[model samples]
Target: MTDISTTSRRNFMKLAATAGGGLVLAFSWTNTLASAVMEVLDDTNLASGKIDFNSYLSISPDDVITIFSPNPELGQNIKTSFPMIVAEELDADWTKVKVVQAPLDTNKFERQVTGGSGAVPHSWERLRKAGATARQMLLEAAAKRWKVSADTLTTENGVVVHKASGRKLTYGELATEASKVPVPTDVKLKDTKDFKLIGKAIRNVDNYEMITGKPLYGLDVYRDGMLYAVIQRPKAFGMKLKSVDAAAAKAIPGVVDVVTFKNNVAVVGTSTWQVNKARKALKIDYEAEAPLESSSDHDRIFKELLSSKEATVRRKDGDVEAAFKKAAKVVTAEYQCPFLSHSPMEPMNFFADVRPDGVELIGPIQTPERARADVAKLLNIAPEKVTLELTRLGGGFGRRLYGDYVLEAAELSSIVKKPIKLVWTREDDMTGGTYRPAVRYRFEAALDAKGNMIGYKLRGAGINSGNPTREDNFPSGAVENLLIDSIEHQSPITTGAWRAPITNFLAFAEQAFLDEVAQAAKKDPVQFRLELLDKAKNAPVGAIKYDIDRMKGVINLAAEKAGWGKKEGVSQGFSVYFSHRSYVAQVADVVMKEGKPAVDRIHAAVDCGIVVNLSGAYQQVRGGVIDGLGHAIYSNLTFKDGAAEQSNFNNYRLIRMKEVPEVDVYFVNNGIDPTGLGEPALPPTGGAVANAIYKATGKRLRNQPFINQPELKTV
Candidate 1:
């Protein structure tokens, strides 16, 4: 079966351009000299014979090689890894290569957006060929000047060397002639064993800049005469602005103007502080048909939805009713998790300068191409006339995918007729956040007289959140009689993808419930999961998307590393999950802290299809473990009368440094193309911690954010 995401080819290594000047290797067929050189290189006729190099690689006259990273960097280290992919094939001097964010141009690089942890996997082959194509061109150019066979010569550290003649030429010296060399439709890639910059720890391109507090982030961008702007959103969900008295807001010192748009009131000022200060004074009236709905009401609705027998069964395989009737014992459990906010480290903000001709937007946006087109359409201009550039994002975690913030800034700039930077206060972000939908899951299982599982049923309810969790996700094929059902209720609450999307909650609910099944079956949790995975691998009843063997491998590996049953004093819990095409298994060690469970250490085993950078991969796993643990322990977005109750950090609690646990990470080194590392590591962590907490206290806390129960705190 062809994988559409990977096999769909795009000419990324086409049309390169020089930033300053000289030989950026623009792969234009119109260049006669380039066409000739490419014909000579085409003697090998590699994978594909369509040479179209996107504008990414460039060489300045000073021999400075710049690689424009196509994906947005949301601190996932793509700025380092993407360049490393090219550098490995190009054999360029790593120290001399500089990486930069590419402007939003889909024509140059198809799908310049970054999400789903696909940056490396999607462009791995294209980038390697892109770099190799340039290297071969430079070698060919050097051979012409040195009067030597290109094959007889070798390249190293940005220089081509004719060892037999004791001659060498720098890439800079031959870049001019190399620019005329036609790009190979396909180029020979390096063997994995020969990779230098890849699969090795390399510092991120912006590490030094970020550590030294350099101006590289969106918030750091400054434009002269750019006014600061803040929007006052409706107080409640589905509410509309009725009226606004902006007299006091306009009278405030340094206040520029107040503009009422379709849904929001914007206060413009000389500075962010002044804008925020004046925003509070604006007497804005909001109107709704009835009282805004609250969490209390939503909870009641969700409970009813979960219990309702009328639901669309996503999948079914065998006789579920017969299996349940034949079972010796049956058990059921319920789990619920409240709404969650993205709350990225950096508050949402974007800078826009709208003009009659077009608009220029510079900010931390994950989907810049989509944002640019949306802005262009709203402004009634051609999409080509708009340019969107990326800046370093403090954190994305799926938040930057939405371009509303970008549009907000662009709309404000178009109205004010000046460059504007619209900033969302932490309060605004928390309240208006596109959150992870609150969910409720009810699971049922049947066991025979021998305690072997026979039947399975799952019914889940969520508000405005679709089944991001596929019905065939996992454990679906492991059972003989299985059925998956879901009920989704529409709501005014805005929700978007969170870390692992649906798997974030699904893993917790399913894994925890599976542990209960293990207890009833008289088996260890890890061993029980492994048993089902083995069955799924050997005798799959349906089309299972996940690799059961890979899933079992990580579970066994994590259990082995954590000494699953041998931990003397700590209560251990194990969980395994697959998401974003990667499998992760985690073992959480918990101990009684005060009257509640506290995490002591976490062991993670990941099979993310060949780790790109060991250091970066490790950090991703560790960070994901910590993040999942933190959210599982304490994180919830509540609403009262459709108004967010948790306004800021004061109420929206996050994990503190003192609460961090020692984390150990391991990777399964199967030589396959890279898969996602960011989100796959997160889902299992929640399940591991939740199960550990259950083990420590023998309390099944069905709800998320363990802090929901006051008994979790000693004070």
Candidate 2:
């Protein structure tokens, strides 16, 4: 299957060259024309003859060069950052570079994903090579023309120059000659210090398209004869459709067809509004499952798991029992976090045109490769028969990872035998979401007389919706000398990734508890953490997943910037966490406003390896602060009778413009490779806010949605 996708992409690249140069010059690190060309050349079985450079680069006689990218852009600023890599090495004008989404062809494109905040870091090395390879090829061609050594020809801004000969040629003029040269396997990439565009503050290429409301998103995609669709999923988790009276739905104006599938009903119409109207008009009967009995039942299951004697210990260090026995002061606390919704601005939607021969799918999807395979499996068609088109996502936040909505659209289109667009209304999207699993964490810390940490034991239990396997790649205990155990409290509700900081959510509770331990010892919070990190770094407890030095770097930077121990009137709190391969620490300053905890300012420091686009990196950190603020102080998803209690914004509140506080971000100046910013900033925010709340009220708020305490007065 993988081989077939690779072949298809190579064929597409060949077709792209012969099809009147309809190539879209998009720069990408993951998937691009250069990557496709390289794949065919590298494959021993696939390369039949000398690899042609013309397959990857298309230069018009008019001096225009177009590069094709296979990866989709979903507002994480890859459109700009990825191109910077290409332009930097190709010596092309940044202003002249244009980006377009690459079509799905497994054979030609590499890494057709836009998640895990890995776009820049993963593509950095490869993209530089692609650009340099192309540049070198063009230089070789120019050197031949000028009758000079290749070393004498230096490429500058896509122009090859021979200083002694005073000869120059644009890459476009030498493109044909370069096409015959074999790709160099050992091309040198530019050093970080020599980079002109990589570290610079460049705006997102799609910023104008987004701000002006251009048709860049999947919702904006239109076809000549496309029909709109709305599905009626089960009202509650684990419910099954017993019957659906679609007679009235079909009677609605512009309603084309009504169909029933596995667990939902679909209403197809001429317009989205008409389909929505028809969907609502239809009456659905669902067989309520046992999980829908009550929300308390689910809570009880989680509690039972937490208390269960049997568990898999993720990490265990040095006779915790003996250490606890010798401790002077023992601290134990339990923290609980509720289920969360991804709630992307753009609700899930997909457009699919399924025919007997093939299927054409278009929409906002995060995992294009996964979507292609899933659609093919559902349609029972060869993977090649399925083509997934990616449009700019309004907001992904991991919701688009699950291509169920895409499969639904394909199924509807196949049944109707026409092109159909399936749109989930706000209600449907909210209720039918894959929620962040609710979790309960239990922590026990044994401290010596001087408030020195002796032993730490942590246990976590949650509805395994987000992660079912106790030993998944992530969330598994990467900490040492710690007993990290997880138990699944199975629930019928769907679950998926909600940014980063999944297990780190427990870190907020753990780090806050550490602060409490410090207080019990009359020690400073920052000092305590640094001491613990020192211990974790050298004599480490169980596993050594976190780079203690990197964590300390961020922590110390944030502490120094926030004046960790000097502030008098204002109270200070701090939290440091490492996740998604990025390390972040935040120091929050809180002051009581109208007798409630009001954050005045938050100082953050991050070490996310390398800074790809400084502006985009800063935006992610800033946005993460806001996102964390909302989750800590306000966000919660409550359920009653297995149905979400909060339907929309009115019931489920989000941090508004007025609620945003001043956030100052400081990036550690280590030019390490870049890590994720999208989620690393999130985990620390919740803990920082919790720590701030403690400073204001002198009370530890272990539970999330901290504002809901009845004893606390509202502003």
Models, CA RMSD each: 6.2, 4.7
**Local accuracy of candidate 2 as per-residue lDDT tens digits, 49-133:** 3343322434433355445555667667777777677778888766666665567767645677877877666666667776777
lDDT of 1 at 210: 79
Q: How many clashes does each candidate structure show, in the order listed?
A: 8, 11
Q: What are the per-residue Cα lDDT tens digits for candidate 1 across 1-715?
A: 1111111122222222333334664322122123212232121221354445444476655677777666788878778887787778888888988876666666656667678887777766666666788888888888888777889988888888998878888887887778667655656777788877777887677878778887777888787778999999998897889999999889899999999998899999999999999999999888985558799998898889987887788999899999999999898998888888888889999989999877888889888888998998889899988877778788888888999999999999999999998999999999998899998999899999888889999988988788734788789888989989998888888888888888888898898899999989988898788788878878887779888878888988999999998978799988899899899999999987666678899999999986777778888999988888888888988899889999899999889999999999989988888999888888888778878877888777677888876535432
Instruction: List candidate 2 stretches off by more than 4 Å.
Output: 1-65, 465-481
Model 1 Cα displacement at 608 (Å)?
Answer: 1.0
For candidate 2, the lDDT comes to 0.74
TM-score of each: 0.92, 0.91
Best by lDDT: 1
Worst 10 residues of 2 by lDDT: 468-477
Worst 10 residues of 1 by lDDT: 1-10
Provide the global lDDT of candidate 1 against the true structure: 0.81
